[model samples]
Target: MISANKLAGASSSDKYRQIHDAFEKTGRHWLYNATVGAGLPVNHTVRDLIDSGDTILALSGIFSGTLSWLFLQFDGTVPFTDLVDQAWQQGLTEPDPRVDLSGKDVMRKLVILAREAGYDIEPDQGARGVAGAGALRRRVRRSLL
Candidate 1:
């Protein structure tokens, strides 16, 4: 019943109107959260940027702190274990953080963005997670003092 990227428009207002109309047609009460608290306008914004010939860099991540924390970890400031713990404490991760770490969620978002940008990309065509649960666990253990 809830559609994330079903209808898109040139502008945010147009997208809102389209979504509103769709809900009205369906006679269902719905809530739309395009870029409210998420801090990123994933689809509609990407479409606009692509249309205007501007380069758009999308960093898709879980709702929690995994993606940003991973970047920090890559910088050698934060340990992988700290990032994982922070993600759990901040509730930015899924019920199973592995779902976020698996990179499938990011891949799906990329697939949607690619399709919106006129590319025929299958979900599986996106990159997979280089680190699995066992690898992450090992890295976290190694980081422990």
Candidate 2:
């Protein structure tokens, strides 16, 4: 019969457990980007960028499509409505996409990123949503056109 500790050790080898361990060890976070076809590696992590004093751009959007889809939208090949529909179909958006569109999700992400960068930002302190009725879409369309 396997001992409890042995079983625990065996189970800890699971991929998610390993990832959790890495995160604990390094105090870093990882995000999987389907457009890149892989998780951001350790060297390219947010912590590394912040530590190195490099500028980091984080885009927080409700569209569940891959990062490549986002780029296409930027180029005006994809419509904002279509992106929202796709994200809903993919179960990535709340039943009310407004919650995301209102920039709450983006604010949360920004707060986390700021905290990791050594900023003591309260969740309610620094988040301002730029979301408005068709504003983002109109801006993108205008810029690309």
Candidate 3:
């Protein structure tokens, strides 16, 4: 598990609980390779680089590709609903698509990033000013279905 944020008020346990709750509620298992980037240990990297600052400039990244596997299963003409069903069966999404579809995953990542970037970002604060991510949302939705 990685350090989810670096705010003054949010405890380490609180962030871990939030990640745990997200996984529990969505029934999706996550295994992140904290070594892929960030030269230091996961928690320390976040604290030294991202949390020691303010004004998060940008956020971007890729997500899981379970839907890609699901799509490749089809010979042709796969029904959207069937794909949706399969994605669910694979634990690829939450009970609702809204969370994954609405960029909440990235939002969570961004909250973590913003905190890394040294801002005191909470989930609600990240959620407060979201630009419409229409294209990205559509792609995630299509993948889910």
- What lDDT score belongs to each candidate, Candidate 1 first? 0.57, 0.49, 0.52
Q: Would you list the clashing residue pairs of candidate 1?
A: 64-92
lDDT string for model 3 (17-76, tens) is 686578789978533424212323443455555546644466454432443445566544
TM-score of 1: 0.50
Best by TM-score: 1
Give the clash count for each candidate.
1, 0, 6
For candidate 3, give the lDDT of residue 28.
Answer: 82
Please name the candidate that would achieve the greatest lDDT relative to the true structure: 1
Tell me the TM-score of each prediction against the true structure.
0.50, 0.40, 0.42
Better of 1 and 2 by TM-score: 1
Candidate 3: C-alpha lDDT: 0.52
lDDT of 1: 0.57
